[model samples]
Target: MAIALVLVLVVVGSVLFHVLSPWWWTPIASNWSYIDTTLVITFWITGFVFSAVVLFMAYCVYRFRHKEGATAHYEPESRKLESWLTAVTAIGVAAMLAPGLYVWSQFINVPKDATEVEVVAQQWQWSFRLPGKDGKLGTSNVRLVSADNPLGINPDDPNSKDDVVVEAADLHLQIGKPVKMLLRSIDVLHDFYVPEFRAKMDLVPGMVTYFWLTPTRTGTFEVLCAELCGTGHNFMRGTVLVDTEQDYATWLEKQATFAQLSTPAKVGALATPAKDVAKVE
Candidate 1:
């Protein structure tokens, strides 16, 4: 009786805890509420399986309890039971994976109208590059990475000369503008994640990965490295701000382009702005 009572309480207690839990996803600031919906679907399917399995075990223990002169039934696997289990398990697995496949399809296809933004991740730090007046970013190479050219943009790629570099600073995006984030890593594997954006992707040393999102609201969001890189992994933090059109333009103007930063004569003049930007969250 005590064992059966505990088994029933497990299901009831767990359900109550989940429904009353204060911990929940942060309010979404992007258009990927589909991600949250998919998660809930997954949870419900898995939770049902968990509860059913536990309850079934309890039922079996109670129904098959030994009695005076009772002998255990030695019947081996039943074909009907096996068939039912197989079909039900297949359906449950399909139900969990189907929604993710749909979300993944949307994740990789970037809209042509979306603005391109480059995100460069190194040990415990994040930098960003955005197209400048020419409306295109120049090519970059990891071999060219250095203190003077941290982003490694090809100096000869005229397309890159006007790229706005936001080094060691917060990235700002215009609210409602679709952005195709181009991710790269200089040192090791990292992941660019913003819970509010409902998106993240890995940064591999020799490869680039991408995901796109349109900022659906104006606010500042924390950037977290979702992958464990090294001892400094926990410190790999940054911020992204979604701004109004006018505010975005103003912030854009304040940032220095590659051409400006690379010029020796303008280096001294740029230091103050760089410091101010670095101070921002």
Candidate 2:
């Protein structure tokens, strides 16, 4: 009796803490709300099953307590009860799996007009590459990286020459537009996570991963590095700004290029012709 009471108290207290706790992922503001609702349903079903089983066991102990001359009742399991329990379990499992699979399908299939953006991860910083007027991102490789080539743009490919590289800059997107994020990493694995957005994906080196989100609210959200990469992992923070179309364009224009933004220009300067130099002399 004492043990049953203690177990009941512990379970109730734990469930209450989880229900009333202030700590939780920020409210869903994107398409992930469907996922959150499904999670709630799962929790309720599981909670009910746990509570029912434990309470029934406790009741059995109290009602059928051992007496002075009472013999143990040995009865095999009933097919009817077993069948009902199995059906109930199957229904609960289906209830959880149905929504999960549906949401997963939606998450993988991005809208036709969704904008594709490439996010590259390094040891402790984040860099982004936006497709230019061509609406195509050129190929990239870490092997092409050097002191002069931070973004590893392929020199042989003219398409990459016009790619807009945003280094250490906050990412901005137009509000209400679906954005498909292609994640890559130059070093170890890292996870791109935003609590409020309720979306996250792991960035693996030499492999392209992806996630999609449509910003419903226009505000600045913190981009946290969820995976432990190194000693400086905690400081690996970034910002995402959701703004209006006009604001997004303005922000994009202000970002300088690798050549224009570098302290010392890496692109070779144009040579003065022999005649022009002689005329100056």
Candidate 3:
């Protein structure tokens, strides 16, 4: 009787604590509310199963307690019981998985008017690239990576000349504008995650992966690396600022284009050597 009472109390206490828990998810800032809905569904289904199983165990223990002169019966060949257990378990699992599958389908299909933004990840840093007046990002080549051309933008491409390159800086997005984030890793693996946004994806080397989100509010959000690449993974943080339309335009105007940044490097490369200058003199 005491054991059964304790089991019942455990279920009741757990449910009460979950309902009144002070710690909960952060307020969502993006359009992934369905993710939260799916989570709640999972919790409800699992909680129900847990409560039922534990209560059943308690009832069995109390009702079948060894009586003073009771003899143990051994008749354990009930196909009906096994079949019922199997069916219930299958139903429980399917109920949990169905919502997640539906949400995942919506996650992958981006809107037609969404703008593209490239996110470059290294072992310990985050960088971003935005389309220029041409409204397109230029092709990139790993071989072209150097001190002057860190992002490896193809200099020969006319489309690349105006691309806005923001190296290890805060990324600003205009509020309510849908953006498709293109993720790439120059070194090991990384993940771009913002808690408020509630969406994240992996950054793989030699391949580009992507996801989309629209900034529903204007504020500064901390960017964290969800993957542990190395020792510095803990410090690999960045900032994302969601701004109004005029503020976003002002920030963009202050950023230098690929051509503007590469001009000095090109000039230095084309400069005549000191020895050649003396010979010419």
Candidate 4:
């Protein structure tokens, strides 16, 4: 009796906590609410199965409790009952898998007009690159990186020369525009996750990964690194600012390029050969 009462209280308390909890993924802001709905469907189906099975077992335990001289009865499986249970299980699995695959399809196929942006990750920091007047993004490589080559910009590629690189700055996007993000990591694996967008993808070193989302609401959102990179992993945070077209354009204009920021005086000083200069003097 005491054990039963304790179990009842525990169930009630857990239900109340689930219902009253303030914590949850930031309220769905995109069309991916269907994902959440599908998840809830799975939850319900699983919960029903677990509760029904346990309660039925409990009922059998109480109803068929060993009474003095009570005889035992054994029977083989009933075809009708087994068939019904199998059918129910199949239906539940179908219900869960169908919607999940549907959502995954949508997540993979990005619209043609979606704006493309690149996110570059390094040790404990995040950077971004946006296309300029041209709609193409230039290629990059880790081997070209050095103190002089901050972004490892492909010098041979003319298209990369004009690409705007925003280092250690908040990424900006225009509202209602589908944005496709290309993720690259310079060092280790990291995850680009924005809870409000309901989407995320991993950034693997020496490879490119991608994801797409359209921001329906205009606001600043947090960009968190979901993968464990190093000791400062928890501090790897950035911001995503969604704004109007004009605002986005204004923000884009403020970004400076590697060449533009490099001073001719400094470049000449670094490029001068020591032996040639000494002979000239």
Q: What are the models' TM-scores?
A: 0.93, 0.86, 0.89, 0.85
lDDT of 4 by residue, 125-167 (tens): 8999887777778788989877766667776776776688888
The lDDT per prediction is: 0.92, 0.80, 0.91, 0.81
Predicted structure with the largest lDDT when compared to the true one: 1
Better of 1 and 4 by TM-score: 1
What's model 3's lDDT at 169? 94
lDDT of candidate 2 over 50-156, digit per residue (tens): 88888887778777887899998897888999999999999989988998898899888989898888888888988888766577677878898766666776666
Error of 1 at 106 (Å): 0.8
Model 1 residue runs over 4 Å out of place are: 266-281
Ten residues in sequence with the least summed lDDT for candidate 2: 261-270
lDDT of 1 at 48: 96
* The 10-residue segment with the lowest total lDDT in model 3: 263-272
Q: Which stretches of candidate 3 lie over 4 Å from their true place?
A: 265-281
Order of quality (lDDT): 1, 3, 4, 2
Q: Candidate 4: misplaced stretches above 4 Å?
A: 1-11, 75-81, 258-281
Query: In candidate 2, which residue ranges exceed 4 Å CA deviation?
Result: 76-78, 258-264, 267-281
User: Mind giving the per-residue lDDT tens digits that candidate 3 earns over 95-207?
Assistant: 99999999999889999989899999987999999999999999998788887788888999999999999999999999999999999998899999999998999999899
> What digit string (tens of lDDT, one per residue) describes model 1 on residues 215-267?
99999999999999999999999999999999999999999999988875454
Error of 4 at 108 (Å): 0.6
User: Candidate 4, residue 72: CA error in Å?
Assistant: 4.0
